[model samples]
Each structure stands twice: as C-alpha cells, then as structure tokens.
Target: MKKVLLLTCVLCLAASLAGAADTIKIGVMAPLTGAWASEGQEMKQIVDLLGEELNAKGGLLGQQVEIISEDDGGDPKTAALAAQRLSTQEVIASIGTYGSAITEASQNIYDEAGILQVATGSTAVRLSEKGLQYFFRTSPRDDDQGKVIARTIMEKGVKKVAVLHDNSTYSKGLADEAKAILEEQGIEIVFYDALTPGENDYTAILTKLKAAAPEIVLATTYYPETGLLLRQKKEMGWDVQLVGGDANSNPDLIKIAGADAAAGYLMICPPVPKDLPSEEAQNFLAAFEKKYGGTPGSIWAVLAGDAFLVIAEAIKATESTDPEELADYLHTSLKDFPGLTGLLSFNEKGDRVGDVYRVYTVDDQGNFKLLQ
Candidate 1:
C-alpha cells in the first residue's frame, strides 16, 4: 500500500509539472489596492483580455500564456516584495506598474533576475537613463511631455504660470521639465512647490496658490491630487485655468472633481482610443468594449496593452524568451511596429521613440476633446 501511494503521488506531481509547462507565465505588477487602484485594475484587465485573445489565436510559442499578477499597493516597499515574488515564479517577463517611483522599486530586481520588464505608465526620464538591458517602457519620457506642456501653455499665451507637483518621482520630474522650458522661454513662474499627496484638503495649498495669481496653474500630479485640487480650487472661487500632465488623464479625475469642476481643464497626454487613427486601435477598442462592457477609462491602460503587444511581438519574432535576445531585438530590430497606441519603437536606451503627447481638454460633458 505504501509503494502504491508513492507511485500515485509521483504521477500527480508529474502531471502538475506538465500542466505548468503547457503555459508561459508572465508577471503583472500593479497597485491592485491603493490610491491608484483604478489604474492598476484597468492595467490588469487590459493585459488579461489581451492574453485571452492570444490564447484563442493558438497561444504563444505553442504554450498558453498565464498572467501572474501581484499587487504593489502603489508603494515602493510593497513593489519590491512583489517583484521578488515574481522573480521566483518562472515568469519570462513582466508588464506594468503606473507610478515612476513604484516602477523604479522593481526595476533592479527584474534586471538582476534576467526578466524583461515593459513599463506601461512610469514616465520619469531617468528610468531609461540607467541603461538596464531588460528595461523598456511604452510611455513617453517626462522631458518630451514637458516640452509639449510648455508649448501648449505658451500657445495659450499664459505669461505667468504656477507649477505644482505632489513630490512623487513622476510628478516632480514632469514639473521640473515644464518649469525649465517655461523659464527659458521667458514665461514667469509665479509659484513653484510640491504638495503632500493623499491629503483631503488642499485648501491651504490653494490659498497659497491663489495669492500667486498666476495666469494658469500647471499641475504635474496624479489624478487623485489633481481631482482634489480642481474641486477645491472651484470651492475657493479661484477661476485660474488649470493644465495637467499625463498623469492626470484618468477618468477618475472627472469623477473626483465632478463635471462642473473639471470642465474646461486642459491636459497633455497620449491620444486615447477614440482619437487613435489606426484601424488596429479601433478594432482593439471595439473588442475591449465588447468584452468589458465599455472602453478603458484611461490612456494609461491602453499603454499597458501596447506593452503586452510589443512583448508578444518580440517573443514571436525571436522565437525565444531569453531576456538578452528579447532586449536586443527591441533595441536594434523593432521599428514602426503597429501598436494599439501608435507605431512603437525603442531607442538604444529602451525609451519609446516618438512624440506621443497631445493636448486635450475636458468638456463640460466629461469627455476628453483632442486639441491637437
């Protein structure tokens, strides 16, 4: 009886191993429960939907694709733990994460473990500057976005502008970029400061900002803070126009600030699905709506979709999951690869090459209207 039991146990273990080998495991790290939960949730949903579609088309490299997800809680310490867990899971690659600081926490872990990472929304310019062979991002760099924001502000003829950030890595980077450009162009920076994030009342900040009396308030912060700023700015009866950076492009901003408060707010970000001219984007939008009952809430989620597509393309083209080979292909070989967002390509530093930011305004109806 003991021998028979041993035989059965061995067979069961072998079957489990076989089942695992039949699928390719990919890791997704996002803030599943945190201030950025909406962004993280959308990122997971988009990647999962993409994986399902890939499997329906016969999977990748003759193996079904499995997404191993971990919640980073939108905190650096939490992201490190998530990355460590993913490194041991036999995942060939990882996709995600939204905030720049959160992504930075996991970047070294993946690189040292020989896992290729494609960041979806972390846009800090220094991320690609580190020369990590396995690091790449679908999001444009902060410097590029800064130029766009500065130019848009200039076009609006705002001589004096107030720059605000939440002191997060991503927010501060963007604020600095726009600030430099605005200064060089002789635009007066009336006020420049960072706000403590996750605060309920920005009334004190707004009170200080109102004193500055700038023509426009350029907020380089995330949706949550931006939403509060907008709502509070209205309550304080400050009519100064507010312009936001890419991080403020989520639908939750409108929900947080309310349509009346958010209306006419300008932002610079990548074009959303409806504005994407490619048939590929249109088709993806249709498929996403069909499956999820509506389109994604932000362009950041669509950027995640692009990240997944590029990884899949690299795997299919090279026919290998080796990190070095995949990175080499992405850096040297891939060019104008049609992505859900646009033609995606990477420079030697692994930054997506192309100007991706566009100026958009929030309408009274809570819709993002493309200005350019």
Candidate 2:
C-alpha cells in the first residue's frame, strides 16, 4: 500500500512538470515602479487583458500562454537583469523596457539568448540601427517624428527655436534629430541643452532660455520633466511656443502643468486610434474603454496591445514559438497587421514601416486637438 501511494505521488509530480513544459511563456519587461510607472502599468494591464483573451480562444500552438512580467524600474541595469532572468525562464520572446536607453542596454542579453524582443515604447532611431537581429519596435522611430515636427514648425513661420532634452536616450535622440532637421530648413537654433530628469526646479534653465528669446521651444522629454519645464517657463513669463516629442503627449502633462500652462503646447506623435479610419481600431478603442474603465492614459497602452497581437499572430502563422522562426516570420511575413495604432509592418531594420505622425496641441480644456 505504501509503494502504491508513492507511485501515485510520483505520477502527479511528473504530470505537473509536463503541463508546465507545455505552457508558452512570454516575458513582459516594464517599469512597474519609478518615474514611468504609470505608463508601464497601462502596458501591463493591456498585455494581461490580451493574454486572457488569447487563452479564452484556445491559446497558441495547443498550449496555454503565460506572461511573466518583471519590473525594470526604468533603469538600464535593471532592464539587463530582467532580460537575463527572463531568458533563463524559457520565454520565447519578450516585450518592453519602454525607454530607449534601457532597451539598448538590455538588447545584447536578448540577442545572446536568441530571444525576440518587441519594443512597445522605445523610439530612439539607433535601436534599429544597431543591427540587432532580435529587436523590433511597434512604435515609430524618432527621426520620422522629427521630420514631422520640423515641417510643422516651419509651417508656423517659426524661424528661431530652442531644443532641450532630458539627456535620456529617447529624449536626446529626438532632440538631436529635430535640431538637425530645423537647421537644414534654415531655422536658427538659439539654444540647445540637456536637463537632468527628476530635478525639482528648472528656473535657471528657463532664465537662460529667456535670454536666448527663441521663438519656439522644443522639448523632447517625458511628462514629469516636461511639465515642470513648461510651468517654469510660464512662471518666468517667457513668451514662446512650446512643442515636444511623443512622450509629452500624455494627459499627465496637463495634470502636472495645470490646464492653463499646458494649453497651446504642441506635440508630434503617432495618431491616436480613437477616431481613426480603421474599423478594427475603433473596435479596439471601444473595447479598451469598456474593459479598463477609461480611455487609455497613454499611447503605451495601444502599443502594448499591438505588440501582443503581433506576437500572437506570428506564433499562429508559424505554429512554433522558436525564437528564430518567430523572428523570420516577423521580418518577412508580418505585413499590414491591423494593429490598434495603425497598419503595422516591420522594415528590414526592425523599425515600423510607413508610420504616420500627427501634430497635436493641448486645448484649454486639456484635450488634444489634431493641428489643422
């Protein structure tokens, strides 16, 4: 009787191990706590919701899909560690580490492990330029956004501009690109500087910017710092047009800077899908609002959903989760994927192909209006 009982225990344990082996694991890396935690939380929520939907429809390749999420704290070193840990856990692919600097810092680890990484938010052009075989982004690159911003500024008859960044990989890359495009268009850059993120005050920087008297101020930083800078600019009574990168498009900017201060500030970003021409996009917007209890607080939510869809589609098409095969399908076959954000496709360099950017300005009510 004792021997028979022991055999039953062994069989149950073996079955448990086999079931675990049959589950498809995907890694989710994001800043669950830190300056970017709000955005990261939204991304995580979208991924979790999508995972549930996929499982409800009979998961991928006859296996249950599981998302193993890790918090990177929006730090590069932490991102690398998270990537290393996820690689060891048999994740077929990983998504995120939102900031470009963190993603760049962690790419080598995923590359060495041959794990596909779909970047949901990182937009530094160098991310794709690094020839990383396993790295791809659902977001548009900074250069594309820069061009749109430059053209918008030129159209506004702004001849003198100031460029500022938070010295982050994403901010600096977009700032530099915009500066170059502005210069090429014969616009004088009166001031170009980098600010340390998380600083309590930027009065001194605003004083210097006042001296330059730029007609337009272009900031390529995340919301917290961008809000601070804009508020300071207003308090200092520096009259200038303000514009920023995609990161600055979040509603939190108005919340931080106050509706009055954020009013009339423009941002170059991917078009929000709420009223887009795509019927699928409209459905996604409605479903997301219904499930999440609000409109998405940031674009990261949309990109996160798109990243999940892209990965699931590849898995379904290839009928395998092997990283190499998945990467091959993404590069060669994933075209015109009707993502919530847009029609998605990857170029040879792993950047989204033919992305469209729009210029938006904050209205007095803290709502975004597409620039006519």
- Please name the candidate that would achieve the greatest TM-score relative to the true structure: 1
Query: What is the Cα-based TM-score of model 2?
Result: 0.95
User: Pick by lDDT: which candidate is best?
Assistant: 1
The residue pairs in collision within model 1 are none
- TM-score computed on alpha carbons, candidate 1: 0.98
lDDT of each: 0.92, 0.86
Off by over 4 Å in 2: 1-13
- TM-score of every candidate relative to the true structure: 0.98, 0.95
Please estimate how well model 1 matches the true structure, expressed as its whole-model Cα lDDT: 0.92
Q: Report clash pairs, candidate 2.
A: none
Q: Report the C-alpha displacement of residue 143, candidate 2, in angstroms.
A: 1.1
